[model samples]
Target: MTEPAGETPIFERIGGAATVDRLVDRFYDRMDSLPEASGIRAMHAPDLGPVREVLKRYLGEWLGGPPLYSAERGHPRLRQRHLHIPIGAAERDAWLLCMQGALEETVADPQLRAGIYDAMARLADWMRNIPEDGRDQAAP
Candidate 1:
């Protein structure tokens, strides 16, 4: 069937809720094991189950799938929500690393993957609350 008018939403292009869930699963799994992500990982609870579900909803809606996150959590004041987390340059980069890896594994379109990565990288940086030290370095 011909796609409806306007841009094909990223949500549909990425295969909707099920695909978003898989991406979140991969993201968290990488977070669980990546050394570069250890600092960020420590910020989570011993079990990642709760967070994973929450993120699935958030990402599902964020990528144009459905309004799952807002229906549950209200506006995504991401920076305010993460204010308690000690996000700095390192934490931001670590999060991005997992997200990039997840996107690569899940999204076949290279351009779409790169676009999502870029958006995520920007969002990750915005979550940082700590003042940038001169040494704030990019994620390896």
Candidate 2:
């Protein structure tokens, strides 16, 4: 079905959960390799397996596919979950950069890409937990 303005659902426009999964995979892969992401990357466990799965499930529900993440993990409480992480400006930007790169590589539709990117930017900014003075250094 079409939206009121004749726009397609974001899920269908971006090929649904499969596409979101691919985008998350590519995003983590980029993060795993990029030196700029080392700080945030180090916050994760040594293995990326869980991270990959969690993001896939989260995005699946987030992108209007299925409620995989919320069904299992309950409310995202994204800010609460990220409170332990030292999410300064650099980390936030780095995360957004990796995600942007992945979105660019995985999505072919311009409208879908723009919508996803905008939402992601807002979420990433909201996830920031570090104080402006940057004193917090504890791990996530």
Cα lDDT, all candidates: 0.84, 0.82
TM-score of 1: 0.89
Which candidate should be chosen as best, given TM-score against the real structure? 1
Worst 10 residues of 2 by lDDT: 1-10
lDDT of 1 by residue, 11-42 (tens): 88978887888899999999999999989899
Clash pairs of candidate 1? Answer: none
TM-scores for all predictions: 0.89, 0.86
lDDT at position 40, candidate 1? 89
Clashes of each: 0, 0
Pairs that clash in candidate 2: none
Q: Residue by residue across 1-140, what tens digits does model 2's lDDT show? A: 12346565666678888898899999999999999888879889999989899999888777766778999999998788878676878889999989999999999988778878888888887777775665543333
Superposed model 2: Cα runs more than 4 Å off:
1-8, 133-140
